[model samples]
Target: MAFQQGLSGLNSSSKALDVISNNVANASTVGFKNSGTVFADAYASSLTGAVSKIQIGIGSAVQAVRQAFTQGNVTTTSNPLDMAINGNGFFEIELQNGGYALSRNGQFDINKEGYIVTSLGDRLMGYQAIDPVSGDVYAPATASVDTFRPLIVPASGVGAIETSEISLNLNLSADAEVIPTPAPPAAAIDPSDPLTYTYSTGIPIFDSLGKEHTLSFYFVRRSDVVDTTTAPPTYSEWDAYTVVDNDTSTLTHNSTIGFDGVGRVAAVTPHVTAGVTPPTNGSVFSALLGTDAVNPNVSTLGLNAITQFGGESKPRELKQDGAPPGEISGLSISRNGIIQARYSNGDTKDVGIVNLTTVRNNNGLSPIGNNYWVETPESGGFARGTPGNGMNGVISAGQVEESNVDLTQELVQMIIQQRNYQANAQSIRTQDQILQTLVNLR
Candidate 1:
């Protein structure tokens, strides 16, 4: 009985030492959790019944090993894809075998196929972005056993956007002299000839195919006057020509532009000629074609904001809503775990949202290899939520969580276990000596 008790103590001390050694070994590992060994005493029962007092103890055995799920320290990294959770949650990962795992490790990178994966090739799971067909984002109904999908980035370039509207704000020079004589007819006006027009500006427009074209606007002051009594006489008529490239046949010539007594533009009438060929796909055009094969309204020249002021002609604001195809420039994540990809064309798109899952029984999770944990019956099912939602932690990008193990504490425990093992060995040696003495006396 003494031998058995000594052996059990030795085994328990060895197991404690192993646990301490493991904690010290993984002190530098990322997202590592420390474990503690528990011991329970074994007792012998009589055949008839166990006595209330005077029960004999046989030995000791390992009761259980409890894992610590405390928060780890976060360290910043240069890798933008790395992430760290600040509170209580784990990043869901999809294993190669179609099973799922949970981890606090956020060392991630983009795979060759543009999927976000861990170092061991397991794909990170998350909520998908808006669907292309429905244009609606997905919202899960509840947390379940299988509510995860692998996160993948769109590799192709962001698609182009056609120009839909153009806005212009300009100040025309009021001191400019009107044409000495009647300007040439719309047919005779030449965009290349300086005498044909007073002011011209070029605007770049995009087509459905992402092709660019130059839209040129030529303004010619007319001889007609609306208020000659004003300090600066206001012109009642001006000829505006809309030309695409140098195609005179497709020109919108002799459009009327009128000004009030105060030199404020009052009315604009754009003219469109018939029987003109459509602009080529890749060719530069001076005017954008509308649905009816006519030049679209390319200016807000008639707005009261447009004034012929006594200053240098200048456009205050010129804006267009069009963009060319763009390549991926970078990626970013928000505190709420929404991942966005930025493109060269100054456009950003939602790729995915990282899913944070918490369990009711965090200590009950079974640790598999590679700093990962699996769901077990003892561990209550996932309490699914996005980062920063409810009790979930906010995510930090370009950072990782370090191991929670404290090396100093583990070293101290190691010394204690070593002393325990030595004491148990001494007890076994003393018991052997007593038996040897008894046999010698006999």
Candidate 2:
């Protein structure tokens, strides 16, 4: 009986050593959870019907190997795809074999196919950017498991948007000399010649095919032809011409701008042609695309905020609602798990939202190596949701969670386990010596 107890003690101590050694080995592993061994006493019933209060315990056995799910320390990394959970949650990953896995390790990168994948090629699951049927980008209302797909960066580029509306705010110099009228049949002004126009400004505009064209506006101050004796010099006039891509043939010079003495614009007369009709206030000019294009109608260009001031001619604000095709320049993950892709054209789009799954019994999950866990019957079903929602944790981008194993504590426990094994061996040796003494007596 003593030998059996000593043997069991040795076995239990060995198991303790194994657990501690594993903890120490994985101390540097990312997203690693340490485990500790639990012991249970072995006992047997006496042959007598009545139970004795002082029954000796036979031995000790391993009760369980409990895992610690405490939060790990986060280390920031230079990689933008690296992520860490700040609280409770796991990133849902789709395995190559179509199986689903959960992990806290977020080291990821874009694969050759543009899909975001882990080091092991497991695809990260998230809500897709575009809706197949509706062709609309995914939003909060459209988030769901049904919409979940592997996120892919647009390799080619984000499609172009044609120039639709432009707003211009400019201050024209009022003190500039006015140009006299040309002969009755005035020769068409050449844009390259500075004498043809008082001031010129150029802005890049996009076409249907994402092609860029410089839309130039030339302003020429005109001599006041209205009588000034009876009227208190109330207004100043300026003839404006629109030219596209240095093509003087496309130039139209019928637009006129009138400003009051205080430098505020009072009236405007936009150019009118067969295919072009500017807005009533002459503030909006239309750009005509080729007649064979899908939408042949003209694109509106707004210049309503023009002012004739005494200062030098300058553009205060110039903005357009068009964008050329853009390449993916960078990526970011928000605290709410929204992944945004930034483009070279200064445009940004929400690619997807990383999905987080929380289990009711994290301790019950079965570890499948690679710092991943598989759902087991004891773990219960997973509750899926975005990060920072409810009990789930928020995502920390460009960061990784380090192992939770404490090397110092494990080393102390290793010493204790070694002492335990030694004590158990000593017990067995003492028992053997007692048997040897009995044999000598015989």
lDDT of each: 0.75, 0.82
Model 2, C-alpha of 141: deviation from truth (Å):
5.1
Angstrom error of the Cα, residue 300, model 2: value is: 2.7
Q: Can you tell me which runs of candidate 2 are displaced by over 4 Å? A: 1-5, 47-51, 58-60, 129-141, 174-184, 187-196, 221-239, 253-282, 289-297, 304-310, 326-330, 342-347
Q: Backbone clash tally for model 2?
A: 0
Query: At residue 39, what lDDT does model 1 achieve?
Result: 96
Once model 2 is optimally superposed onto the true structure by TM-score, how far is the C-alpha of residue 368 displaced, in angstroms?
Answer: 1.7
lDDT tens digits, residue span 11-110, model 1: 9999999999988989999999989998999877788875547776778989998899999999999998999999999999999987888999999999
Candidate 1 contains a number of clashing pairs equal to: 3
Least well predicted 10-residue stretch by lDDT in candidate 2: 225-234
Quality of model 2 by C-alpha lDDT: 0.82
- Estimated TM-score per prediction? 0.72, 0.82
Predicted structure with the largest TM-score when compared to the true one: 2
Write the residue-wise lDDT of candidate 2 on 105-205 in tens digits: 98999999888899999999877767568554543455676777776665655778888676668998987888766886875466877887788897887
Give model 1 RMSD, 1 decimal. Answer: 6.8
Structure candidate 2, residue pairs in collision: none
